[model samples]
Target: MQPETIKTQQPDLTGAAPAARLHQVAAFAGLSADQTAHLAQPSNIERSIADHMIENMVTTLAIPVGVATGLLVDGQEVMVPLAIEETSIVSFVTDSARKCRPAGGITTSMSGTVMIAQIQLVHVPDPYRTRTLILERRDEIGALCDACDPTLLRMGGGFRDIEVRIIDTAAGPMVVLHLLIDTRDAMGANTVNTMAEAVAPRLKEWTGAQPLLRILSNLADRRLARAHATWRPADIGGEAVRDAIVLAYRFADADPYRATTNNKGIMNGISAVVLATGNDTRAVEAGAHAYAARSGRYRSLSQWEVDAEGNLCGSIELPMAVGLVGGATRTHPTARVLLAITGAKTAEGLARIIAAVGLVQNFGALHALTTDGIQKGHMARHASNVAIDAGAVGEDVAQVAQEMIARRSINVETAKAILAERQSQRAD
Candidate 1:
């Protein structure tokens, strides 16, 4: 028997009622026809056929990835697509965005893309000789690299600067070449790596420096993006709220133990979208934490300050290297759909949206910790899963889950209790 060939389909938006178009995902099932059409617009429908190898390599499982709605980014309403299974992440970001809505939402900006390429030079007769040789030949070397990617140059993007370093490592004394390239709108990793590899032969001929590693580095400190928001004192008014928020930031900043977890809260939303859309989450994480410790200390990813007017101001700056085209973004079916949803023009535009989502996520955690407590809200959403696991069906799943939470017990034990109680009453 031939297995079904699952062709990717969009909710048909051609004159269909709005609620009728949200096809695959259950989360969007309740949306109106207008909402479905808006979501299913041609701009948001991205499709790609998976090569058999690609399907075999990455993962065989398809996890539920949903868009976090009610987001107002840069005064624009957005539905953020997040590809993660963890409970509370989507809800947390949505809650945070709602809190920030009155403050005009989040504003973000990115440094124009500057990517790094690393070249390792080994077995040099004299380390200083190779360093001087490379520096002297920089313009020639840069020109050679620039020629390899003419399209980038035509678009006002190409090699901008060259740097060299001599390091004494456990292996031996080695010289390194650093190529700084302005990538413009795309994630410059592939661009920079190609240019670096193109120059390796020339570099060998000049100084006899054996190039070992010709690759792009993820430490995109030069390509940083930042987002900031402010909350009124009246909005956070009570002493407990103020103290708890400040304490949360301080704890993360003061202790590396806490900072990683704190940053994880921010990445919960950021990474989900990154993974769903086929962006390199590992590279982004590596660059982010490395940049965080560039000052020689592992500190918090965000800073919190109280203004003279007593408003709580928060800001975050981190290395974010993301692209809208090429690599996984173009290859994956859903990743393409995610970019279509945003209608973003450039990679930097997407980065700003990502930063905004991170800020919103942080706000959600801080707000919960400062007020009602994180577990209270998180457990509420988690209850449904517990009910389902406990064998509750359809509507009864939510009912049993809510009842369990209302009684301050939302565990397997509680779920079982509710199930038994309901079954007994029905039997009577």
Candidate 2:
């Protein structure tokens, strides 16, 4: 017997009502009624908004948002909202910040909100000669770029300078032009990209080369943010712990494997705030990792040392290409609220806060590593999740989690056993 072929039309969800779009997607994807109904529940973001935010939107995944308290940056106490699923980060960062408060908390500085746009020219007739020609036309190129964004220019931000470099690649030699622009209050991807595109034709004509890959560079070295904080030996468990932390940092600075995890711990705090504020986490991560490897070797993004007062001092510097005026920062309601809570009046202010948070977060991880080990506190917090996963609810969840922690056995099986023992005792 021959089977009949079934022709199904692909669902056109463009401009369709949210409910209609959901139904069509559900039907096309062969979702069960229960699964479809489960996804139909009220999300933190409205379906209408989510649909417009991205393509092929089926549902919104909500992450728990919590705030770290008592983070003092540049003499101001600010509460930072962190949207992440990982446990113990908020508490650890809060504790680290409190420990630093006795020594004046975290002080931060920014290297301006400058971003770079790169124009790659290949097959140039004479690469070095083209570079010289580009330098001679710096004023013209700057004016051309400045003209791309009138609002930016009026707001005291536009083209600042131009740089030309000649490099050899596997393909051949190439001439690269770097357009430095002050992005003002924006991350400036779009602004700089437009400038690069607008100036590419002129660059190609001058160099007699083909222009390719005119875009913004994620290695935002020009937009660097730095932070430093001191912790008294008495405040951070005395000289022994402080010295151990410095040693740990030395290990990370010497090895790529350790540096990767050390950098990730820093980003755990920075990325959470970036996501909560609706900024680009990937861009920040890329820039940070690239900056770490800028010295021809991968190393820690932060430094730790012992100061003259026998206190532990920590500092961090990284490329922070985050913005306040565009993208999801303006469109997401929750992001606006988070920004208000942060009290950052400009992009530079926000970057400073993020850098400070990264420094403190790294300190917290080092403190944990040198003292009680990272998993001790981490597992204690994770016990609650295991309890919930083992079918404990409400107050029972806390009871089961506590029992598991007390027993030094944090797992689903332990949680279930604890719950079972409780039920049996209640019946008796």
Candidate 3:
């Protein structure tokens, strides 16, 4: 087995390098000498497959990974690593998480980590009868599934059960089979997809229908994550601030146009952590949006309400289908570092942390929207990007950004003029 690397994560070892931090954390946790040594090695991820993992060996895409600290989930403190280019998300969420530290932080839960695989069969003569036949032979079908991945079966992860549905479409009726799998540590896409295809020949024979489109469904409603948090009125500005946040949520719930933007803000935080963990951001994104519109109306995935004690209560529920093993999570070295930083040992723990982070993020965002507005804190950070774009370097970048925010003229042109003036002064 490859050696493990423990990052230094102590109160005093804040700015230490990765190796140093790992040792500190190991010592702090009272790890054995051999275990600590095993965890202190550097990460190595080479070409695992033939161009499937990294095709053409192009340059890597870069996203700034920032630590959102002071978040307490289930009574344990965790630092979330967020990878994104958006402004103000990490800062505000970090602030809210810090303030929420004393209030027991965030509480989270999850349904079973189950994923769906759809087997589409068209041209069925008796769709209902076909459904019955498919359900009756679930054990036999499951056996075929387990045969494809003996290792997964041995690991106690395999096809859990099967479901058959007969739906009437424009042309005719189609028999859709839903295969549910307990994926355990992995996402189980390939495992379940393989299971679906293994039963295709039998499904075709049993129903006398054509089997097509056997794949995993991104609408992972079966696997859900939820988080709940409460912020006192005095803690979050005042009672008016809490009520205003509820009003903002009402606005999103009333219209799809606003709801899209609202949930996008929520994902602005969720997707960053999702990417940092090396999970499928696209799949999570698809599941989130689909779940948002699951009520036949595209609405916010979060809810804000005023409590009797006048504290602001925030809760969010979404289809959070992430994994600790398989795909990029297993293949990427940086992903390993970030996951370690988050201290999520299992897929379920990671899901809970992600959901909690998203909730705190939404909480911070709505407070800003209801009070000082999104542009102030958001644009202040945008100023730095504008300065960089205008060719400002080092100290000049900070000066130019400060000037842009002060003058309320944050644009590429303003940054360039200020940079030129600073250079002229230096020359003189």
Candidate 4:
């Protein structure tokens, strides 16, 4: 006899209710009824909004949102909401901010909110001549680009300048047009991309060059955010600790291996706020890393040194391509609340806040690394997670975690053993 064949039906989830969609997905995946209901539990974001935010939407994944206090940016005391899963980041930032508060907190400034859009013109008969031709038609090109977004122009932002360059590539020599645009209070990816597309055809018509890859460049060199802070030796564990931080920064500045991790530490703070505000975290991260490597050698995004007062000073500069409008910023309810909490009225203001947070976060990491080490504090904070993972419940969770930390052995195995001991004692 032939073997029995079974076929599973794929449910049509289009236009289905959120609960029904969950049930269908669970059934298809052979999940139990309890599992299906668990997946349908209400979250901060409504199902309809999650469905519209992206295609083929399932349930929303929730990340813990914590606030870091004592951050004084530009002479304003601000509490920043960070959406992240990592342990100790919020606590470390808060501690770092407290240490720097006596030194006037963090002073920040932004270069501008300018974003670059690149239009690659290939197969040009005369690359240099084509570049000049495009530059000469600046007025016409600006008019076309500005026409794409009249609202941006009305808001005191739009086409600012135009640049053309001819460079040799593996394929051949190509002329690239850089459209410098001030996006104002927005991240401007969409604005600049639309402008590039709007003006690409005109360039092709004028120079008989093929227009390819018209898009916004994430490098965002024109949109730089900077921050600086000083920590007195008395505040940061004396001169020895301060000098050690400078040496640690030197390692990152000299070696690419160290730089990658060092930059990641900065992003831990920047990306958390970016996610909390519904900004483009990936864009900000890409711009930051690219800016770090602009000198051909990847180096630390932040600098640390001893100031004239024998205090440790830290500064960070990176491209902050974030926006206060558009995308999920206005749509997501939690993001709107988080943005309001930061008290940033403009894109530049938000960029400055993020830069300050990055600098302080870098300082916190260096302080921990140069002192008792990172794992001590990090693992201590993570102990509760290990306790829960080991099946400790309610009050037992904290007890087990505390015991693990006291013993300096934070692991799931140890957590389980401790929980077992507590249960045995209770039974006795």
Q: What is the lDDT of candidate 2?
A: 0.87
lDDT, candidate 2, 303-413, per-residue tens:
999999798999999999999988989877667666766778899999999998899989999999999999999999899899999999988998999999899999998
Off by over 4 Å in 4: 1-42
Candidate models: Cα lDDT each: 0.77, 0.87, 0.83, 0.88
The TM-scores, one per candidate, come to: 0.85, 0.89, 0.89, 0.90
What ranking emerges by TM-score with the best candidate at the front? Answer: 4, 3, 2, 1
| Model 1 lDDT tens row, 1-428 | 11122121223233344344245332333444454554565443332344442654432455566666656666565666787878888878766665655656677889878898999999887999889988999889889889988998998889889989999998889999999998887787889989988999988999887989999989998888899877665555555575678789999998999888888888887888778667889989898888878889888888887778666778888888988767878866557666666556788888888888888788788888778888988899889999999999977897899899889998988899899999999899
Note the residue pairs that clash in candidate 3: 4-39, 5-39, 6-22, 6-39, 7-21, 7-22, 8-21, 8-22
In the range 223-307, model 4's lDDT, one tens digit per residue, is 9999999898998999999999999999999999999999999999999999999999999999999999999999999999998
After superposition, candidate 2 runs with Cα above 4 Å error: 1-42, 426-428
Error of 4 at 358 (Å): 0.3
**RMSD, each candidate, Å?**
8.5, 14.2, 5.7, 14.0
Writing each residue's lDDT as its tens digit, candidate 3 over 222-314 gives 899999988888878888888899999999998999999899988988999999988999999999999999989899999989778777888
Better of 1 and 2 by lDDT: 2
